[model samples]
Target: MSTHFEERSGVILCRTSWGSWYQTMEEVFIEVNVPHGTSGKEVRCNLGSKHIELHVKGQEIFKGKLFGTTVSDEGTWTLEDKCLIRIVLMKTNREAGNCWASLLEGQYCADAWVQDQMQRKLTLERFHRENPGFDFSGAEISGNFAGGGPDFSNLQK
Candidate 1:
C-alpha cells in the first residue's frame, strides 16, 4: 500500500515497473526504458489533459488518467540512446505552485516518510517566499509545522 520514492534535487522521483517519474512545480518528467536498439517509431505516447497512454515496441507500458491536469500541447516525448524515452509535461496550474503526489490517479502515492519530507520542503519554500528578509535556505523544519498538532495559544497555570 506504500510506494517508495527517491528525492533528487528537491524532487521526489517515483519508480515503477514501467519506469520512473518526477515532478517540479511546473512540469512532470517521465522516463521509460525500452528494449535496446528500439527506434523512435516503435514508441508511441499520447498525452492528454488528464490521460496518458504510452506504447513501446507495440507493448503497452502505461495507460491511465494523470493525477493532475497538464497542457496537452506542451507535452513532449523523445527517444534517448535509442532505448530510453523521456517525456516532459507542462502542468496547467504552474502559478499555483502545487506538488503532485503521483503521476497517475490512484497510483504510486508517496509513503508517509516521503509525504513528510515533501510537506517540510513545501513549508520551507513558503516561509522563504513570505519572509524574504531572512535567509531560510538551510533551515530544517521539525514537528508538525503545518498545524493539526496540540495548540498552545493559551497556557494554563
Candidate 2:
C-alpha cells in the first residue's frame, strides 16, 4: 500500500507489497553504486517463472526468468550517478479452470507500489489487479526486479 527505501552497504533498497484472498505478495528492488572509474557499465539478474526485465537509464540491460516459475522477474543496474534494482511478482490462477474469470469482471484494476523501513529492516511490495474484462478476483504482476538484499523474508501466506 506504500513505498519505502533504505540505505545499506552503499546500496538503496526499495520494497512494496499487496494483499488478496488467496495470497499476499511482496517485491524488492535494489540499487548499488558501482565503484568509481568502472567501465563495465551494466549489471542484471532474473529469476522465477515471471521473466523479469531490467533496464538502466531507460535502456534494457538485463532479461531473464525467476527460477522455474513464470510468475516473477527482477532486474538491477548501476549507472554513473546511481544504481537501481526492481522486483515484481504476480498472484496467478495457474489452475485449469475459469475461477479467475468469475470474480473481477468489469471492475477497475487497482495497482499500488510501496516502500517501508523500520529499525534495521526494509520492506518493498507491489500490488496489481488482474481484471481480465470478466469478473476475475485474482491478479498478478507479470514483471519484477532482480537480486540483492534479503531473500524476500517478509513474504508470508
TM per model?
0.72, 0.23
The most accurate candidate by lDDT is 1
lDDT of 1 by residue, 1-157 (tens): 0011113125556777868887654677899988889998888899999999999889899889998899999999999999889999988975323667778888867666765665555555555544556555567768765432223436663
RMSD of each: 7.2, 16.6
Candidate 1 colliding pairs: none
Which runs in model 2 stand beyond 4 Å of their true positions? 1-25, 40-157
Give Cα distance to truth, residue 15, candidate 2, Å: 13
Q: Which window of ten consecutive residues has the lowest lDDT sum in model 1?
A: 1-10
The deviation in Å at residue 19 for candidate 1 is 1.8
Winner by TM-score: 1
